[model samples]
Target: MSNGKTKTDIPFRLDRLPWSRWHVLVVVALGITWILDGLEVTIVGVISDVLQKPLRWHCRHLRQVSWVLLLNRGSRGSYRFLLPHRQVREEEALHDHLGTYIVGTVLSAFSFNFASIAVFRIITGLGIGGEYSAINSAIDELIPARVRGWVDLAINGSWWVGTMVGSALSLYLLNPAFFPIDLGWRLSFAVGASLGLAVLLIRRYLPESPRWLLVHGREEEAKEVVSEIENKVSHQTGKELEEPNKTLEINPIGSVGFGTVFHSVFGRYPKRAVLGLWLMAGQAFLYNAIFFTYALLLSKFYGVPVDQTGLYIFPFAIGNFVGPLLIGKLFDTFGRKPMIAFTYIFSGVLLAITGYLFMIGVLSAITQTLAWVVIFFFASAGASSAYLTVSEVFPLEIRAMAIALFYAVGTAIGGVAAPSIFGALIGSGSPVNVFYGYLVGAILMAAAGVVEIAFGVKAERKSLEEVAAPLSEVIENPY
Candidate 1:
C-alpha cells in the first residue's frame, strides 16, 4: 500500500468514495459466516447425548442406508413406489435389545466421537477458518481507517450474537419438557442449519471484495464495485460523496492468493505468525476446556443435574457475549500487547480463584454462579480479542492459512482434549481439581501473553502490509 492511502482506499476505487449497498451486503455475508463459526462450537453440547447413544448398525450399513434413502428420493419414476417397499420396519430397525447393542454402543463412540467429529470438525474448522480471516480482511479492505474501528467492532461483535443465538436455541428449543427428549437436540441442530441457509440466501446479493480485486490486478472490476457503492450511499444520504485526495499503490508482493501464506510471504514474518498461532492455540484450548466440557464436569464431579447444568450455561454465554468488543476497543485504543497481557494475567488469576472456590466448597449456589459468570466473561473477552490481535499481526497474503492452522490445531489439542483432561484429573475425587487444571491453563495463557508482549511489537499503528514484515525487521524493534 502507498504511504498516504487510508485503509479504505485499499478496497475501494476513487470514483466510489462512499460505501455502497454491495459493501453492506458483503459485510452481512461475512457476518453470517462468523455466526455459523460460533454456532458450531455452542451446538455440540446440545447434541452430545444424541451422538453418544449406540446405533445398532455398522458404519458401512448406516452409510449404505443413508445413500439408499437419498437415491430413492431423487428418482422421479419407480423410486417413489419402491421407497415405501425399501423402508426398514420397526422390528427390522437396529435396536439395543439384542447382544449387538453392547457391541454397537461401544462402537458408537468411535463412530460419533472419533469419526464424525473428526471429519465434520475439519469441514467446520475450514469454514470457520475462512470466516475469521475473510471477514476481517474484507472489512479492512472496504471500510476506511477512520471508522474502521467501529466496523471491526460490529464484525467482531457478531461472535457474541452467534453465542446468544446458539445458547437460546439450546436452552429453549432443546428443553425436553416442551419437546420430546429424543427430538429436542435434533431441533437445535435444525435451527442452526436454518440460520446458515438464511445467511447464504442473503449473501447472494453481495459483491466480491474490491480490495481483493485491486490486489489481484483487477482494477476495472474494483472500480466498478466502488462506483456502485458510492452511488448507493449518495442516493441513501442525499448528499455528494466527497473523495479524499491521496494516491494509492498496492503492494505487488501482498496481492498474491492463499498459496503465498506458507511460502515466502509468511516465511519472512515467521515469529509474528508463530506468536499469533500460539495465542490462537491458547485461546481455543482454555475456552473449550471450560465451555465445552463444563456441563459434564459439573454433572460428574459436583453431582449437578444436566438440566441445571444447561441452565447455568446461559450466564457463561452472557459473559462471553459481553467480553470481546469492549476488550477489542481497548486493544486498538491502548495497543494490542498491553490489553492482551492484562487480559491473560487477570483471566488466569480469575480462573484459579474460581477453581479454588469450587474445590473448597466455600460458596453458595448463587455465588458459585456469579463466579463462573465473571470467569467466563473475562475468558470470552480475552479470547475474542486474541483473534483481533492475530488478524493485525499477519499480512493479507498468509492471513487465512495462518489463522486456520493455529485455530484448527489449537481446538484439536486444547479444546477436544479438555474434558478428558478434567476427567482424568478428577478421577473420583472432589471436582475441585478441574479448577487446578484451569489454574495451569491460566499460567499458559499468561505465558503466551507475556511472550507476545515481550516479543510482539506494536502493530496497531502500522498498515497491514508493514506489520507483517520479515522476522529480522520485527526483531530489530520489539516493544
Candidate 2:
C-alpha cells in the first residue's frame, strides 16, 4: 500500500470467512446503536403528552428538528467530517462523542424547559446521525457476505427491542399512581441515558473496519485486524478455516471526495439510487406517520388513556421485532427483489384493510392495535431491507455515504411530511380524515414495493464487491 494505491484481496478474504462467534460480537457491539435509537423514539412517543403539559416542554418541535437534523447531517455528512481529523482516532472520537452527547441530552430533559431540551436534542440527533453512517459502514465491511442479510436485518430489527423496553418503561413511569407528573418523564430519559453509557463501554472494544483500512491504504493494519478476527473465530468454533478462493486487484484511493460519491451514485447507478430512495422514503412515511402519533390516535379515537398507550405499543413492537427475525433469511434464500416487494406490498395491503376498518368504526382499540401488529409485522422486515439494499449495492468507497444519502432523501421527502399531516388529521377528530392519511402511507409503501419488483438489485448472498464493484477496482489490458 503506497501513496494512495494498492493491489490486494482484502475484500474477498473478508467475504469468504465462515459465520462464527466473532460475527455475533461485531453485531452486538455495533448494532446496539439501533436499540438506543428505538428507545429514544419510543420514549418520546409515549411521553408526548407529558412533555406538553403545563410545563411547556415543546418537545414536539425539539423532536422534529432533531429528527430532520439526524436524517440530513447525522447519517451522511457528519462522519466524513469527523473521520479525517487526527486529534483523536476515528473509533474513539465517534464513540466517546456519541455517548457524551446522548447522556447530556437525556440529562437536559430534567431542566423542564423548551430551550434547553431543544439544544440537547439537536446535539443528540447529530450524534445518532453520525453513528448511522459509521456503524452501518463498519458492519457491512466486517460481516461475511453469506450471512450479511440476516445479520443486518436482525440488527436493524433490534430497534424494536429498545422500543419494547421503552414502552414498558413508559407504562410504569408515566403512571401518576406510581410517580408524579414531572418526575416520571425525567426518569424515563435517565434510563435511556444509562443504556447509552453501557453501550459506550461496549463500543470501546470494537476495531475499525479492515475493509475501510484496506481501501484507505492501511494494508498492514487491515491484515493485522483480519488475522486477529480469524484467530478469534477459529478458537471459538474449534475448527480450521478454508483459504479464500477469490481475489481482486484494487487501486487503493486515499480519500474519496463528495463530488466523486455523488457522480458515482446518481451518474453511474441511477436506478439503484431511485430504488433506494423509494424504499427508504416509503417506509419512513408509513413508520413516522403511525409510530409517532400512535398514542394520539388511541387516546383520541379509542378512549385509551395515555398511560395505557405503552401497553398497546408493546405488542406492536413485538410484531415489528418478529418480522425481520422470521423473514430475514428469505432475503438470502428467496432473493432480495421478490422478498422485499412481497413484504412491502403485503404490509401495504394489510394497512389499507386496517385503515378502512378503522374508518368504518367497526374496530375497537384492541382490534386496531392487533391490526397494526399484523401490518407492521411485514412492514418491519421491508424497512430493514431498505437499509440492507442501499448499504450493499454501493461501491466500497461510497457505501456509507450512499446509505446516508438515501436515508436523508427518503426522510426528507416522506418522513418529514407524514407526521404533520397525520397529526393534523388526528387533531381534526374525524376517523375518516385520518383514514386519508393512512391511505397515503399505504399507497406510498405499495408503490415502493412495485418499484422494487421492477428494479431492485438481486444482491442476496453476493459479496459486497460483486454486488457493486469497488470504485478502486483495476482492469488490466489483454495487450
Candidate that scores best on lDDT: 2
Quote each prediction's TM-score: 0.75, 0.92
Model 1 weakest lDDT span, ten residues long: 72-81
Q: In each prediction, how many residue pairs overlap at the backbone (N, C-alpha, C within less than 3 A)? A: 1, 1
Q: How much is the lDDT of residue 171 in candidate 2?
A: 88
Worst 10 residues of 2 by lDDT: 68-77
In model 2, the Cα lDDT at residue 191 comes to 79
What residue pairs are clashing in model 2? 74-129
lDDT of 1: 0.53
Residue pairs in clash, model 1: 20-229
